[model samples]
Target: MAKKMGIVALLLFGVYVLCMYWYIFHSGDGKIPSALQGTAADPVMFMSGKELFLSGEYSKIRNFLFFIATPFEWLIYFLILLMGVSRYFEKITTSQTKWKLLQNAGYLFLLSVFVYIVLFPLNYYRYYLSKSYGISTQTFTSWMKDGVLDFWVSFGMSLIIVTVIYWLMKKSEKRWWLYTWLLTIPFTIFVMFIQPVVIDPLYNDFYPLKNKELETKILSLATQANIPAEHVYEVNMAEKTNALNAYVTGIGSNSRIVLWDTTLNRLTDNEILFIMAHEMGHYVEKHIYFGIAGYLLLTLLGLWLTNKAMRPMIARYGQVLKINKISNIRSYPLFLLLTSILLFASDPVSNYISRYQETRADQYAITLMEDREAAVTAFQKLTISGLSEVNPPLLVKWFRYTHPPMLERIYKVADHEGQKQEIPLKEEQKK
Candidate 1:
């Protein structure tokens, strides 16, 4: 049985590599011809001064290693390794316990620690690479502090999630998938709503933008974009990273734009305005709500597919793997493996949706701010500050990029005539 499992694993690994190659390359040009005013033929020229800083061999090596971690490979090996540990744990814990739920939580915590150990080298190297490349400012101690906090938070969440999931599975053998997925929708929405406010503050300091003049300038752009934001925030990302970013998150009253301090200190005023306008575009277009809806649907389908796939595999491998049932705590490694495989399969579709939304937001920002030159210039700064590839391999972009390349963005701005600014909505008019 173990030998057969090995053969199956080898075959699956081959399929994964081949699928990654074919599915990524054959995906399409991903050009958005429908939404934008016009497609630009040329990308914005990168700044000559920062050429070596961003495109140098050092940056290339880091970027290469970064994407390599993302192909869902590490989790597969972890899944295999943890199966041995899972069986050992199941055997040890089987000695009658009154606190079954507590025992299960301990099992999860044990597994989480094992996963942390397995992946720690990659995690630590990423931090080291950041510091070596002059992108990280946080001390190693501070970085480890953040990591430990993240681990505890994940462990806590997993304890609750696993407890409920297994409870459902035990109650109804077949209907658990439906029930679990239905429960997941709300759980996800709640997490998204709270993350910007709750989870984010744990890692970084976020304050209202200290520069009143800049805050007022951003307010003007928000007014133009119809974002009902009452505050503009600056996260003290200068303490941790040199990368520049601004994003809009949360729902209703929680919604706001957060600019990294690095961006505030590094970009020109015109560039900042364009960046804020881009984030505001996301707010006005209701991308957050739409994203939640899209994810809910995708998750529902994903969980269903996982359930279908696992049934056959468990029938064949369950005894050898020591998983007595779907609800068995020992089966989590298998569940994780199947889910990771499904997520990797779904990446091309998810990324395509993300790219279109991002492209539209860029166009919207250009038109709303009415600054074509700034749009081009801002992307150039972003490419340098972020060390973005001007035009990555088509396959890599298809599988990974949520936004269009710097070359595509700059050229698009050049081609676009810009959208006419719409009148502000009535709700803001009363205020």
Candidate 2:
């Protein structure tokens, strides 16, 4: 049973989860938007034959479309249709440096736009699902604005990397993948260092957590965890969502723990502290830097694999898709599509590493707090508030879940032998 759930969740829900994080690239925000906010019923009402919206029964089917079916559509569209378009575009650009580079940018832009068009339905359905779940609060106009902004950000960043990658391929021919892999390590680190300060603020408002009292408790936890104390932030997501989340983003001086304002409002002080400590565990464990290393390493492997496979794949499908050279601007989509397919195949490996890290953090939180009951209670609240799947099959756990199920967390926290320490948060905040 556990293995079944894990497999289903990994192949199906895992894909959706990947796309879910890809959007905001973090957990959601929640603050009461309009007076109607948080008061509105779920937009997706249960059918007569279905269980209640929050009963966990609806999760299997609802998630089937969001996490599984729709994502496949986009994947196919990119791999098959877009690759065809890319090859067609490549036929026109002459192999001159200035013109070819110029054409590469132009072709890349067209591919992005086309991919966006093909993927929009899935994206909209994602928004619809969030609204249905009563998680999203933004108006349609606002949602569209964010979507556009997200696209432009992706396009601009991808353009820079794709252009450089293809240029290296043009120059090195045989070893371009190695050079590109080398470039991404420093590039990835630079992005991690700057993302919190530069990119996150563009979509949502962030302020120092509003409750000074709770802020003090978080700082104390940080001290216990030996993490920096100054930079806890509250994201203004109340206007856009009711989902509760907190995550550690950025690195070094730029590193900070960001909490959804909704989390602060909805969860108890004990719960919030546990969540923060879990995040602090990441820093204490140096998981972020390690994660970067792991990703760059995988990317290196993926690039090498793609290079090996490209000749045969293009030979088999090239005439059909319309391109000749691997480095052709139009053939770039095939490169991307193939690499993504490779990564998708290996998600289980990546997610397994993530789950271990998250469990370590959970253990850290429980031990540091020395409050087993609070830890269990915190997991319960997190599951209830987020409507998380509590007993996902082992497959899902292996591939889709970054953290263990709430049920597993409860047992782990309960079973661990740790010291008892009295701390603040005996009385809950009024909110």
Candidate 3:
């Protein structure tokens, strides 16, 4: 039965990949209004013929990789359980040490190494694809260095979280999920609070915006928006990526408005101001707090569901999977497997919420900056830089998009410009 299920899963995955590839690469260009089109001398198209071809091919492969990553991870965990590898780790750790902490550390280290090795090829391919597409500027050595850092950071955090969860399970098997959920609230906040200050610097150098004049303008804009920001910081991203980006991150005093060097070098002051205004909108609207609240709610439900499901599955397949109980250290893979599946299933809901918030931010930016041309052109440049599909397919939009498609954003802002222009003309006619 399990073998048949695995085969079916593979077949479905293969079919989905082929369908998505055709949909992404073969879909025609999005409709652009006649008014929006430029003259033959200076075209205003989002992507030229060559660019469109490259973007489509790039989008298809990246989407396929993303679609398979989670399921592939789940398969690894499933194999570990089915092959009794996890059970073997548990036995070895027990024989080596009676101390629960040390045993867990040993087992998790081994598991982390195994998983890292298995996933490295997929991860490397993602980087290689970006490099080939002219998006990533990072070399193989620098990329490997970052990858190693990522692995260690991930392992350290996972060890802390898993150790606490197992301890809670042993102490209060029935209510461990609730208690773990409660603990996660503070832990998540702590991570967010310190991320900009403590974690981000490890990856790239950040300094006060070198363009002091632009920094003054940004600060003035922040003041007008009633955002209590002191400075704008710029990160050196020219060495790493060609894509442009800016974001607001952290909480309270640690909060930062950061621009990638690429963004500053590529965009005009007005465009950068529009982008900053959009990021400020996220803060003014308190989207971060709302996002945290939403995440906690979903995780609460996910934990409850995981708890309800784990026990019965263990009872039924204890001997076959060699996981006797939820509290058994060997059952860590089972817990992660269930949670991974839940998170994957919830992507659509989460992505929809993100898109809605992003749309609101866009509206706020347009209202604040009142530069429709800048806003429109900024998005166009961003799309070109990232090689983003202007209008992604429905499934990709629903499952993967965290913001509105580029074509949608461009049209909305361009229409806003037209509406503003019409208002003054109507007033003059009334006179």
Candidate 4:
């Protein structure tokens, strides 16, 4: 049975790898078409920037295909974690007590530390690459602090959630997936609410939009757009990265617009207003609800399918984990790892849905803001600020990026003919 389970696990692992590879190499051009407009083009129009490759106009991207294959590297690291967790669970065969829990947690922590060590190089590049391009404000020490803080926060959260999920899974047996998902909705809501209030404060300082002029303008934009927002705030993003960003989150009274300090410092008041208006458009268009609903549906389907497919494998490999009690913390890591692996393996499908939603928000932004040039400039600035590939490979863009490339967004905004404005640099005034 162990031999059979091993063979099946190896086969499944192979399938996972092949699927990831196929997703990267064979996926369609992941950019929207130049001629496309509105929500019609959204949902699957991430085929624009790749028309160059689709037309076979660029061989450069082909040569750099290996660079696009690195998300698979993330997969391998996660699989190692899965194996470690499985090993810990197997060690729990003799006893399932308080001491066992401590042992497993200790092992998981050590494994996590090991993964962090392995991830340090790539993680360094992810940040330094941004800095090398003049996009990051993260000092090395600050980066290390943030990394450790984030990891522990994540680890703690996952520990609790995975424990609960596994407990539910065992308690409900065959109906575990359904019950766990129902529980997850409320869990998700609680997390989302606390995230801005609790989690965000850990990373960035948040203050009410204290500038009356900017505050008034933002309020006015919300009023004009009928976006139903009362709170607007600015986050101290300067502590981390120099890039600009803004977003509206939550619903009704919980809804608020957050501006990165860099964004406020960089964009003109009018441009800022326009950007805020675009964020308001998302709320106005009910994009948040759309996102939430879509997420739930996808999650439901994903859980159902994964549960169905994994049950047999669980029976086969479940013994290797010695997980008699679903509540065992020892089982949490491996299950979470497998769950993440499955989700990561399904990136293409997930990306497809996400790309659609983003395209809708883009259109919503255009219609809401009615300021084409600001949108275009925003895209351009973001691209430059983040060192984004103006035209990335279809597979890379799809499997990796949530937003359409900056060039494509800029082109769309330009094509729409928004009023252009010259933005004065804050630094230039000091000079």
Top-scoring candidate (lDDT): 3
For residues 1-431, what per-residue lDDT tens digits would candidate 4 score against the true structure? 54555466567666766765565456544454555433221211222333323323222333233343343344443345335544554455424445544554554565567667766776786677556545577899988889989889977875566556666776776787788789778777777667777787898788898788889878887888776566689998887786789987655455668999888888887678777876776677777777777777777877777677556655665665454444444455445555665666667776776666666667776776787667666665654455455555665665566666554665555554322223222242224
Q: Model 3, 31-100: lDDT tens per residue? A: 3445544411112344466676787788778877887788788888887887788999989888999998
Off by over 4 Å in 4: 1-85, 89-111, 317-334, 416-431
- Candidate 2 on 1-431: residue-level lDDT in tens? 33443355357646666765443222222211242211111111111112233535334534444445444643554444333656555544444345655776677766777778877887788788768766578889999989988988898888889888888988987899999998998899888999998999989987898899999998998887776678589998888887688999998788889999888888789888888888988889999988988998899999999888877876775665566777766677667767877876788899889989999998888788877667766665565555666555444456567777665566577643331122122222112
| TM-score to true structure, per model | 0.85, 0.80, 0.91, 0.75
lDDT of 1 by residue, 1-431 (tens): 66666677667756766665543345444333354322332222233434444454444455456455554454454345334778666556566455878777778777788778877998898899778767788899999999999999998888888888888888986888899988998898788888889988999988999989988999988877666667899999888887889998877677768999999998888889999988888887888898989888888888898788767877876777766678787887777777776777787888899889998899788888788777776776777676666666666677668888776777778635532121111242234
Give lDDT: candidate 3, residue 413.
Answer: 68
User: What TM-score does candidate 1 reach?
Assistant: 0.85
Residue 337 lDDT in model 2?
66
Clashes of each: 0, 13, 0, 7
lDDT of each model, Cα atoms only? 0.73, 0.70, 0.84, 0.62
The order of the candidates by TM-score, greatest first, is 3, 1, 2, 4
TM-score of 4: 0.75
- RMSD to true structure for each model, in Å: 7.9, 10.1, 5.5, 7.2
lDDT of 4 at 229: 62
Q: What is candidate 3's local distance difference test score?
A: 0.84
**How high is the lDDT of residue 225 in model 4?**
78
Q: Against the true structure, whose TM-score is highest?
A: 3
Q: Which residue runs of candidate 2 sit more than 4 Å off their true CA positions?
A: 1-58, 66-83, 91-98, 415-431
